[model samples]
Target: MDVDNGMLLCPTHDALFDKGFISFNDDGSIYISNKIDKREYELLNINKDIKLNFKREQLPYIKWHRENEVQ
Candidate 1:
């Protein structure tokens, strides 16, 4: 993970983003549950409202469908 930019880089799968923080679910699925600071939230809101693709560069983690892997 790139600590400076808060970009998470999973080696087992592809999933990256500039989130304030993150947590994993029981099913091994990653969910964005970051609580942004007031100032940060404002900026994020602006980006979201403008439909900016922040996660565009990140590949989604699609491991559930793999028959050998079970979370």
Candidate 2:
């Protein structure tokens, strides 16, 4: 586990993110969670076109998170 290969998501987002229920694109755009209820957007802050502050090096980790952890 590389320390710098991690994301800075909030606790809620982190849980989903790590499990690949949520993810980000190569350009750092967020991937919405299908499992999460749309009505709970305000509580989870789910939004379209959301860009995370990620560096290029974090891409591999992001991909791994998406591919290996997706439900």
Candidate 3:
């Protein structure tokens, strides 16, 4: 795996991401899976307002995750 193919996320967010509960749009906007309950958003401290400052080189990896890993 490439070193650039990684993101720095907290444990909770990391787990959620690993499980395909979250992703990101090309613009870096957070994309929560439909499978996640609305109520759990508050408990998980995640919201639609979250965004990432990602490099252009990371887009390919992000795209792969969105297309293959996200729910």
Best by TM-score: 3
Per-residue C-alpha lDDT of model 1 across residues 11-31, encoded as one tens digit per residue: 322321323233333343444
- Stretches of candidate 2 off by over 4 Å are none
RMSD of each: 11.2, 1.8, 0.9
lDDT of each: 0.32, 0.76, 0.91
How good is model 3 by TM-score?
0.93
Worst 10 residues of 2 by lDDT: 1-10
Arranged by lDDT, best first: 3, 2, 1
TM-score of each: 0.21, 0.76, 0.93
Q: Provide the global lDDT of candidate 2 against the true structure.
A: 0.76
In model 3, which runs have C-alpha deviations exceeding 4 angstroms? none
Better of 1 and 2 by lDDT: 2
Residue pair clashes in candidate 2:
none
Whole-model alpha-carbon lDDT for candidate 3 = 0.91
